[model samples]
Target chain A: MDLATAGLKTTDHDGIIRIDFIERNILDEANIQLIGEGLNHVVDAMDEPKLVICFENVEHLSSAALGVLITASNRVGSKGGQLRLSDINEQILEVFRITRLDQMFQIYDTSAEAMSAFS
Target chain B: MAESPGHHDERRDSDSSRSGVVVLHDVRTELDSLQRAVVDGIRHAGYDEASTFAVRLALEEAVANAFRHGNGEDPEKVVTVEFKISDEKVWIAVEDEGCGFDPDAVPDPTEEANLEIPSGRGIMLMRAYMTDVSIVAPGNRVEMVFRPAG
Candidate 1:
């Protein structure tokens, strides 16, 4: 089931799939839906079990967007697969800290580091 | 009987003394403008980047809760937002036209059993980012405050 997800950029690194998000800010319902649907596509298209979501440019992430991440994490976990994050801005990292999601998701300094985690 | 969208208004005091009120329909399209106005207002009030980010995050969460849970995404309903910036504090309030829930009853999202649950984290993030979070008007309205660093 291929869905239209213009908000995300996908790349294949070895066997790990890396999804770099282009949306710098995820605020309104439309953008939130974009992230949610984009992740759904990634999860569904996972011939490989490992995935890394990079927030290199996303400075503002609303709780709604966080909900999308949580849902994606759950979907990956259900398949005995892993989902991780990289390049999170410091300000946005505070949000993850406040919610303690930093503990739930493995976070790294770069996409390379996150990709290496799959090994 | 649905009221048309774009029927809302925004009012800023003539003095422009770092305070204003924005009344909006439950329309989702209006949120982007509201958030931009609030962010610009807070920045103009001399909040640093970190403080501004925290306040903005909390404000977005509160407003999203009103639109999503409070009004059940009913465009006919209304969501009223009020914000004030003082010398040392920034305050925001969001009220929805739906029957409110008990904030106390929301379980902690950080709990191991609840980590994967996505619904309850909005309230938790609001409380975490804001200096104070209070539910008023029978839980229909949420008020949050942020105290800036010196």
Candidate 2:
């Protein structure tokens, strides 16, 4: 499943998965659908729930997109796995802070940090 | 260019002319269809992706405001939108038929009192995304502008 049409790529490393939103755009419905669907696929393919989603190139995000992120986080959490965010741009991070979702999910400044934190 | 009241041209190519008037309509559900149409028009006019998204979101907030507050959810009324692009600037105006609102009266979203509230952020978001924003219809019309992305 395509999580975003904006050229996002997924990678698996040490049971930690990283999703990079390759192109820069707000994480709106179109891309969210892709992200959500793709995340589900990746999780299903994994034997464990340990995964970290890294929004590498994303610059802005809307509330709708955040909803999708929360949904993915919950899915990972329910399976006794972890969901993490890393490399989030400041503008998009402000939206997360404003919506108070920053408190719900663990955020890191880099992918390695997120993967290291995930257990 | 002004045409006489008696003159009518059905195929004036106004959408492409860039010289036509853009009307601003109030925010209302009845105008939801129209708002989508305007966004379609903007897309058809070849605006970039970011601009299109910004305008669409801003238009939704504006129309929702008109519906929930301005016209008091009156379905019979109408909200109008008019816009034209020229000299690398796109001007958009939205007008509602509802009682006017005070821009100053709106709570600042950044203020502590308004931070948790969802109602006050729409206009501020519009202002942040658009190059210019103004209330022209007193109680009804909102106008915004964006410079065409190079």
Q: Which TM-score value belongs to model 2? A: 0.52
Location of the lowest summed lDDT over 10 successive residues in candidate 2 chain B: B3-12
| Candidate 1 TM-score over all chains jointly | 0.90
Q: Write the per-residue lDDT of candidate 1 for residues B1-150, one digit (tens) a residue.
A: 133454434455444436656767743577777778777777766678888778877887888889888999897778888888765788898889899988878888888898778778888888888899999958999988899755
Q: Give me the runs in candidate 2 sitting further than 4 Å from their true place.
A: A1-119, B1-36
Clashing pairs in model 1, backbone N/Cα/C closer than 3 A? none
Q: Which regions of candidate 1 deviate over 4 angstroms? A: A1-5, B1-16
Candidate 2's C-alpha lDDT?
0.63
Error of 1 at A118 (Å): 1.7
Query: What's the true lDDT of residue B110 in model 1?
Result: 85
CAPRI rating of model 1: medium
The DockQ figures for the candidates are 0.70, 0.07
Displacement of residue A40 (Cα, Å) in model 1 is 0.5
